[model samples]
Every structure is written in structure tokens, then in C-alpha cells.
Target: MNEHITEIVIFTALFLLVSGMGFVAARWRRADNLASLNEWGLGGRNFGSWITWFLVGGDLYTAYTFVAVPALLFGAGATGFFAVPYTVITYPLVMLVLIRLWSVSHVHGLVTPADFVRVRFGSPTLALLVAITGIVATMPYIALQLIGIEAVLKTMGVTGDLPLIIAFAILAAYTYQSGLRAPALIAFVKDILIYIVILVAVIYIPARLGGFGSIFDAADAKFAKTPAPGDGTLLNANNQLQYITLALGSAMALFLYPHSVTGVLASRSRDVIKRNMSALPAYSLLLGLIALLGYMAIAAGITPIGTDVNTVVPQLFDQMFPDWFTGVAFAAIGIGALVPAAIMSIAAANLFTRNIYKEYLRRDATDAQEARVSKLTSLVVKVGAVLCILLIDPQFSIDLQLIGGVIILQTLPSVALGLFTRWFHRVGLIAGWTAGMTAGMVLLYNIANPANNHAHFGGSAFPLSKLGFDTPMTVYAGFLALIVNLAVAALATVLARRLGSSEGVDGTSPRDYTADAGDPEVKDDLEVAGST
Candidate 1:
């Protein structure tokens, strides 16, 4: 501890400084009243393009990008590049739909995706399922953020749960005080540190190790000796399908996560979201550069702490950089976890407060009541995330995120598609959600990992031979589960129509999906004009 005191001092100082910024963020925009969900949970819904860019980028490209993605590459080789296509495809796909979501949300005063479902199909039951799904999916995601911070701490020789608990307490306190603004304000610092750390790592590290050529050669040589078919510097026949499907499924499920929606909905207008999505893909290039760190780790002979490859990037920095700069890189990762964890907890809390508490516990809950419940629920959500880290430590941090993807994808028919088409009957959506979640669970349960001897819930890649296929190919379980979800929903819709079941009320008009900022029809109760 004495030997590494400089790094610890720097890291702790930066972390505490950011926590201070989080507390000050409550006054950053100084909303007239901090009692409304619209003000507290969505940052007054008025952040401009630049702010939204930093907030959303900081949220999406999280510790998963900083710690897990490189760790994945360090462990599995090219298969980790799945994140590249996931980010690339995510923006264009969501650009076409998120604006519609933003428009409808603004027009109707919706706070969560489930709130939209409640209005669209006029089915509280379906909306409840969407809410539950979002909350359940986000928990492990929050846990992943914690795991990222833990990775950095472990590298710094900080062991046990005390430091983690302290980090969690600080995150919860500031997040409770500042709400969405905490993350939004702190995001500016998080992104700047990440850019510097990544940019320097990409340029300086490769040069120190000879070049990118040596990095690839080192990675190739390492993976070639591995027994796994999918472990290589390049894709092989068996895992190609897994690579493509994981990328595609991850892309589809990303924006559907409540935190991602929270980031987008906080924007001042559809135009801001449009600009952010168009430009957010630039981070994908950074992601690719970050992924290469795994190979660089291989070239530098950096090994993960114990079996957790999640520590590889942090380990690489400690091994390759000076003690002072290593602290900066580590802080980028620790704070990186903080920004997304705050947003995710808040997102899950909003889902519970608006869709569950307000809808069932108290029909007459005012904006203040909802905001109060959301803040409390956010604290509960953080506790749940902490429990997850203490108990169900997955083989890879990314698996926790992939598990979330599989569950959240079940809501596509009810949330993303329902933004445009309500062809899916409310009952059919419930049925599909049930079937999809069950199938996803069973598939995830059956996926065994020979690496760590994990017999179940090992990972998301499902081998095809289990289905009697003669080939050695495997595919992403989430993508396959989504297929089952869509199929079941379609069939259930046909069955409901033939049975003459009640067609639920549609609470929204066509204009709601296309209305822009300052449109007379769109509600002006939410102040979004000047904050830009």
C-alpha cells in the first residue's frame, strides 16, 4: 500500500472531486422545482446537443467499454469486436425510431418506456410487464458498472468490499441529491478523461511495443495455442455466427434499456437526439481502439488478476504507465462506472415509480410524489446492484450485460415497435414476453462454459449442435430468443383477433409521434427551451 500510495491518492482525490461535482450539479441548471419527475429524473428535459452528446456517450460507452470490452478481447480475441458493430448499427437503427419515441414522450408527458406502453395500448398490465422487464434487466447492468470499478480497485491492490461500499454510498448520495443532473454534469469530466486515457493508450502503448503489427502478432500467437475454436485474433467458422448475432442483438437491445432512453429523453428536442445519434458512432472508433488494448496486453505480457479478465485493461495500464498517469487511467474507469451506474439506477427507479407505484399503489400520485418515490427507488436499486456484485459474480462482466440484453429485448414488441405500430394486441404482448423470457432463461441456463467450469448461465453463445445440427457453429442466444418473441407475439395476435377479444384503446394520436419542440399540441409543461 505504501509503494502504491501515489496512485491511490490521485485516484481517491479525483473520485472525491467528481462526487463534489455531482453534488453541485443540483444547481447546474437550477430548475424552478426539483420535485417533479420531469425535473429530477430527466434533467428538465432541456439538455442541448453537446450536453446530450457527452451524457449519452458517457452512459452507453461505460465501464463495459473501458473494462469489460477489453477484458473480453483479452480473454477471447476477435469475438470481442462484436461491440464495434453493436455501436455502429445502434445509432442508425434507433435514429429512425428514437425520434418518434421522443416526440410521443414529449407530447404525452411520458417518463419511461413503460409509460408509453400504458398510453399506446391502453393496457396497464402490459405496461406493468414492460416496467418489470426494464427494472429486472437494468439491475445486472448496474452491477456490471460496479464490477468495472472493482476491476480497477483490484488492480490497485484494494481488496474486499469496504471501498466498493464507500463508492456505492457516494454514488447514491449525490445521485439522490442531483438526480439526472448529477450524471449529466459529471459526464463532461468522465468523457474528457476517457478520451485522454484512450488516445494516449492507443498512440503511446503501440509505439512502446514496436507497433500494431507486434500487438496482433502477439495476440495471434497467444490464441493459436488455445484449444477453443473461437479463440483467435480473427474470426473462425464456428464462432462467426455468434459474432454477428451478438452484435446485432446487442444493437437492438441497447437503446431499449431504460438508462439509454433516459439519456435520449433528457435531450431538449428530437433534433438534439438526431444530432447525437448521428455523431455518437464516432465513439465506436474509440471502442475499436480500446478493444485493441487486449492484444496490446498480450504483447506486453500483462495477465489478469486471478481469473477475472475484467482486470486486464487496468492491469495493462499499471504495468505499462507511470504510477501517476496510471492513476488517471484508473480514475477514468472508476468514474466511468459512476456515471452509468447513476443513470441506470435512476432509469430503473423511474420505471418503478411511474409505471408501478403511480399506476397501482396510488392513482393520484402527483409529480412530487412520483419524484420522491423515484429517488427512494433509485437508492433501493443501487442496493440491489451491490448485492448482485456480492453474490452472483459472473464469469465475465460482459455476460451480466448480455443477460440484460436478452431480457430487455422481450420488450421490443411493446416499446420500440409500439412507438409506430400497435398491431400487437396487449394480451399477445404479455404472452410473447412470457415466452421470450422463459426461452431466454432456459437457453442461458443450458450454455455451459468449459473455461471456468461454469455449468450454467455461462454466457450468451448457444451452440447449434445442441439443436441436432451437424456443424460446429454457435449463435447468440438473445437473437434467437428475440426471434421466438416476435413469432409468438404474431401468432398470439392472430389468435386474439380470431377469438374476438377486446381490442384495447389507443390513447395517442398520429401527431404525437411527429411533433417537434414548441409545437402547440405538444405539452409545454416541461421546460426545455432555454437550457440548450
Candidate 2:
């Protein structure tokens, strides 16, 4: 085979192997019934610490992580390193949020956050809004994974989106058949291959480019000569606060994501969630190594050959390693995209079937029907994601995901706060969601960069200049939107309580928050009720 053909052959073989593992996953769990939503969607909720660790890690640290993080460092310099602290902080933040979510979900057997939001706040309308918001935010994200595979394809000189379409179709099929277990099983292999690829790239690429010092020095010298000042290896006073706030803000929003919550909620126990968070920080170490690939690209004089930052890692692999080894790295990223993409589709589909379809459209739907609808919906979700990759600009796909972060953040007050107390009226939560969402959209649409004449776009810091600021201060949209959300929630909460509105009974007891896996009360389903 020609070199390009050889790369394609190797990638295809590796992907097929992963898909085969996916088909075997349902059998791996020896699921009691494949036709049940619980068995299919959540893997019977029996994932222990080790399996849950890999599943959650794989679900959270995606193809986007492998490609985008390094690409950020490569393209923007120090600002790209924001991913470092964001990932470092994500575990502890999730540790706090997930323990409560696990307890409540396990207690009520709730499958999606929308399910929790609906029951906890006593509002079907709000739950539907949350469900729709989640699906919208997650769709672009699922497509972004295709960008990762497309990156590998482009590096190998493989052209056309047709191949990516075929690959994703295969992914959707197995995921539909095997459900969460499919992705969870394949995650084991994806993580292993990615770890190997990152380890080798970190060690060998630096040596080839002289060393880490040489790489950084070269990057610094290059940027110094170029007109892109302060665009090198360090964050400066101008952007330091923005970086810190964006990093922490993203960490807070990370687990609040519907798919992320779905991933954590599938675990068997509270301790399982905690242990995974503790051990999951090691992914940050891998991420640190991965981020340096950007510096290596700069040292190797690599600039993005395309607009997609997702291609940087693959291009770096093509330049730094042999053809066969490059194929391996390509496979890692391609399969990496597959694992999370599958899980995201499944999560989004579950939200639709449980929170939307069953709640509003078909209250009498059977377990078998729920399973069928979820499978069909999973297929549709993957199809829409592919259309996004085909019809929209890849750069816009990334921006849309950031907007998803903004949208998902709006639910934090309703979902996260509701887990603590129902003192906040449902009406107040809805009002807060509306206010925060409107403010976020307006601010996001108004954000612009002088570098590009594009309107209503750009992922950089939003200047507060129009709001009367001259100090070069900028803030992330997601963080700013969250502040508005909390403020509206607090204000509306006071008014609702003052007006003597009933907050409704929370079926969840105080003891539910600390219940363990084996606790009989955990599965008793004290308040198994929802929208008609």
C-alpha cells in the first residue's frame, strides 16, 4: 500500500477492533435484559470503582481534549494553557457536585439531570427546558468529535467527509445496540492507546527537537520576531485574571454538563464517584504532557495548515513520528473521539426519551418502547451531529460548544441548588433561568475581536468596555452568565418566599445524601413520580 493507504488501513483496522469491543460490551456485563432502558442506558447502574474510573475519565477527557488543548497552546501560546488549571480543578469541583447527585439519583433511580430537575423543583416546564438545552448544547459537542477524526484523516492526506460519515454511522450502530456499556468498554482501550501515544510523543518529540528548553526557547524567539507580541510561553498581567476566572469557571461548569452528570450518575456508589475524582487528576498530568505538544509544534515550525485547531495534534504526529507510529496516534485520537461521541449521543438520547418523550408525548410508554425510542433517538442525535460537521464551519462548531457551556451553566441553580434545599421556589428558578439565558445570549452575540471583522462571534475574552471599562479587563461568557443566574435566583427566591408561595415537598430525605451503595433505603424510590 501507498503511505496514505497504509495509514488508512491501520486506522480502519484499529477502529474495527474498537467497534468489535463495543459490540461485546453488552455481553461483558451479561446484562439481565438488553431491552430495558436501565440495562441499556445506564449499564444497570452497577459500575464499580475501576470501571467507573475509566468510563468517567474517557467520557470527560475526549478527542476534543487530545486535539483542542494542544491546538490551543500551538495557536495562542500561553492562553492555551488555561486547559491545565481547568482540568486540575475539575476533579475537586466534581467531587463536591457528584457525591450529592449520585446519592439523589441512586435514591430515586433518576437517569438524567432533567429528571432530577423536574422532580426536585416540581416543574415539568422547567425540566423540559433543561432537557432541550442539554440536547442542543451536546449536539455540537458530539459533532466536534468528528473534527478530531477529520484531523487525523487530513493529516494522512485523506480527503472528503464521506469517510467520517461512514465511520460515525458504524459508531452509532454499535452504540445503539450496546448502550453505555459499549462506550464504557471501548473507553478502556481508547484510554490505553491515548496514554501510550501521549507518553511516547512527550518523551521522543522533545528529544528530537533537542529538548524542552530548546523547544520553549525556539517558540519564544519565533514569537519575539513576529508581530504577535506577548503571544509566547507566559501569561501576562493583561490576561491573568481572565485566565484564572475562565479556568475556575469552566471547572465549575464541567460536571454541571448534562452528559457529564449522566456519566457520573451511572456509577454504583458514592465512594466510587469520590475515588474516581481523586484518581482522575492523573489525567491532568497526561494533559500537561499533551499540552506541550503545542510547543513542540512551534519548535518544529508547524503552523496550522487549516482553520481547525483539532488538526494540530495529528499534524504534529505526522511530522514527529514514523508513518506506522503516526497511524497509531491517529487511531488513538480517532477512537478517542468514538468513545465520548457514543456516550454523548447516548446521554442526549436518554434525556430526550426520559425527560421529553416519556414525560410529554407518551406517558404510558413501556420499558421496551423506551429502549427502542432511545436507540432511534441515539441514531438521530448522531445524524444531526454529522450534519453539523458537514454544514457548519468547524471553527463555529467549537464556538457553539462554548455556548453549550453557557447554556448548561444556567441549570446549575435549579439542579445543583435543588439538591441542597427547595427553599428556592420553582417559579424563582425558572425566572432565573430565563434572565440568565437572555443575558448570556445578548452578551455573547455582542462579543467581538478587532482581529476579525466577524460579528456575533469569537471565543476570546469578552471586553467589558461597553459597560464602562478602560483597564483592558475581559471575562469569559460562561462565568459572567453564571453570576447573573445566581443573582436572579437569589432575588426571585426572596420574592417568592415573601409572597408565600409553596416550595413543594422534596421526596428526598436528608439521609439520602450520605447513603452508600448497599443501603436498602437508597433504592426504595420514596418519590417515584413525575409529569403526566
Candidate 3:
């Protein structure tokens, strides 16, 4: 424990500094009033290119990217690196869909994707479905951030649940006080520390352990001895299908997460969205480097200290880096967790307040009331996430995120495709969402991990044979579930139209999908609330 003092001190200092920034973030770019959802939930939606870049970067490439990605690589091998290509393709996909979402959302004064769904299809029930999906999907993700922080704490000789409680309490307090601005402000510090630590580790660690070839050779040797399927330095015939589908499915699912959409919507304009999409792939490159650290860990002969493989990277830092640098690296991982966790809680809070609380609980809620409820909801969400980490296994949190992608991908037809075309009837989309979510959950439940004593809710790999296929092919449950969703949505659309089901009035015009920041319909404040 005495040996951990350096890390504890450095990590605590940085944590306090960021905590202070989180509080001060309330005034970072002060608006006239913080009483509205627009101001409290989205930082007034006026952030420029640089702030958006860091904010979105910090939101997307989370502790999952840092801790879980490398840990997956450490434990399984090549499958973990799927995050690389997934992130690579994510920007292009976002470019295609998100700009239109931003425009439509801006003109409609939408604070959540559910708001866009409500306006686009004019179905409050369907919007409620979208909102619930966002909230449920985000909860596990926020829990994963805590897992990341816990990995750091464990490495620093910290034990027990008390530290996690305190850390999340602080996180919840600042997030309630500052709202979206808290994460937006702290994202700068989080990214800087991450960039520095990752750059140093990528360059220094590889050079220290012979070279890239040696690292690959070491990982290959380690995995070759393991009897587990898909545990190898390279993909094989059996797992290759799972690899492709997982990457593709993850790319499609990434931006569908409400927090990702929140980051996109917070941009000042469509141009900012496009420019950031173009620029965000730089983090993908960084992610690729970070993934390689798994191989570096293998080459350095580092083993995880306990049953949790997520500690591989933190232990790797403690083993490889100097004491002070290990502390810095630990701080990077810890603070990295905070930025995304804050954003996700805020995003989920906005969904509940706007779509659920406002629509059902209190239709007459004023802006101040909405903001107040959202702040409290954000606190509850954070506490829920903390409880998730403490109650469930961390590995389960990671797998739940995989399930989250599956659940959220079901929203693609309503949120992403609905941005461009309104061909699918709202009822059909609702039917699709239900079918997809149910099928995905059923499939996830059936895929068990006997080794982990999990009779159900094991992992994301679902067998294709379950779909009446003869061959031994496996695929990502999310992708297969999404196909089911789209097919059902299409078939239902045809039947609904033939049966003369009402398609609901579109509350938006085509020009609304092309509006910019200064457009008359774009509501920046109460004065322009009449325009919406």
C-alpha cells in the first residue's frame, strides 16, 4: 500500500483539479438563463469547432476505448482491435446521417432523438419508446465508465466500494450543477492527458520491448497455447464472420447512442458537424495505437493481477512506466471515465425529462421545471450507474454495453433513416422497434457463458444456426437483430399502408432539414421559441 502512495497522490490531485473544473464549467460560456433544457442540456448548442471536437472525442472514445479495448485485446486477441475499424467507419456513417439530424433537430427545437421522432412521425408513444431505449442503453455505458475508474483504483491499492461512491457523488454533483457544460469543459483536460499518455506509451513501450514484430510474436505465442476459440493473434475461419459483423454492427450502433447524438446536436451548425466528422478520425488513429498496447503488454510479459482482465492496462503501466508517469497514466484513465460518464448521464436525463417527464408526467412543465427535473434525474442516473458497477461484475458491464449496441441499433429505422425519408409509418417503426428489441434480448439471454456461471446474459456472439441456417456460422446479435428490425419495419410499412393506417402528419418541412444556425426557425432562446 505504501508503494501505491505516489499514484494515489498524483491521481487524487488531478481528480480534484478536474472536479473543480467541473464545478466552474457552469460559467464557462454563461447564457442569460440556465433554466431551460436547451441551455442546461446542450451547453446552449453554440459550441464552436474546437470545443465540439474535444467534447465529441471525449464522449465517444471513452474509458471503454482506453481500458476495455486493450483489456479485450489482452484477454482475447485480435477481436478487441475491431474497435479500430469500427471507429474508422463511424465518422463516415455519422457524416451521412447526423448532419440532417442536426438540421431537423435545430429547426424543431429538439433536445433528444425522441423529440425528433415525435415531430417527424407525430407519435408521442413512439417517441416514448425511443426515449426509453436511449435511457436503458446509456445506463450500462455509464456503468462501464465506473468500471474504468475502478480498474485504476484497484491498481492504486484502493479497495472497497466507498471510493467509487465518493467519486460518483462528486461526478453527480458537478453534473447537476453545470449540466452539459461540465463535460464539455473537462473534456479538454481529459483529452490532453489521454493524448500525452497514449502517445508516450505507444512510442516508449514498443521501443522498450524490442519492436512491433516482437510484440505480435509474443501475443501470438501466448494465444496459441490457449484452447479457447477465437483466442489468437489473428482471426480464423470460424470467428471471421463474427469479427466483420461485430465491427460493422458497432459502427452502425455508435452514433445511435443518445450521448453521441447529444454531442452532434450540440454543435453550432451543420458545417461544424461535418468538419468534426472529417476531423474525428484522428482519434481512430489514436485508438489503433491504443489497441496495440495490448500486444505491448503481452511482449512485456505483464499479467493481470487478479480475475478482472480490465486491470491489464493499469497493471501494464505500473510495471512498465516510472512511478510518476504511472500516476499520470492512471489519472488519464480515471478522468477519462468522468468526461463520458457526465455526458451520458446528461443525455439520458434530457431524454427522460423531455420525452417522458414532460410528455406524460407534466405537460405544463416550464423551462425551469424541466431543467430542475433533468438535474435531479442526472443525479439519479449517476447513482444508478454506480450501483450497477458495485452490484454486477465489471465483465458483465462490458457485455451489457454490447447488448446496449444491439438495443440501440434497433432505433436506426426511427432515428437515422427517418432523418432522410419518412416512408415507414410510425406504427410500423414502433412495431419494428419492439420486434427488434425483443429478439435481441431473447438472443442475448440464450447465449450463455458457463465459465462465468452466467446461465444467460453471457455475451454478444449469437449463432447463425439459431436462425435455421445449416452451416456453423456466427454473427453479431446486433447486426442480425437490426436486419430483423428493418425487415419487419418494411413489411409492416407495406401492410399499414395497404390497411389504410394513418401515417401521422410530419411536423417538419424539407427545408427544416437544411436549416443553419441563423435561420428564423432555429430557436436559440425564448424569443425564437415562437418560431419552433
Error of 3 at 253 (Å): 1.1
Model 3 steric clash pairs: none
Q: What 10-residue stretch in candidate 1 is worst by lDDT? A: 523-532
- Between prediction 1 and prediction 2, the one with superior lDDT is 1
Deviation (Å) of 368 in candidate 1? 0.9
What are the runs in model 2 whose C-alpha is more than 4 Å off?
524-532
Q: Give lDDT: candidate 1, residue 320.
A: 86
lDDT (10s digit) by residue, model 3, range 403-504: 888999999999999999999999899989989998898889888776567778777778778778886667888887898899999999999999999989
Q: Tell me the TM-score of model 1.
A: 0.97
Deviation of model 1 at 310, angstroms: 1.0
The digit string of per-residue lDDT tens for model 1 on 25-141 reads 999989888888888999988899999999999999998578878878888998998999889999998898788999998887888999999989999999999999999889888
- Better TM-score candidate (1, 2): 1
lDDT of 1: 0.89
- For model 2, state the Cα shift of residue 275 in Å: 1.1
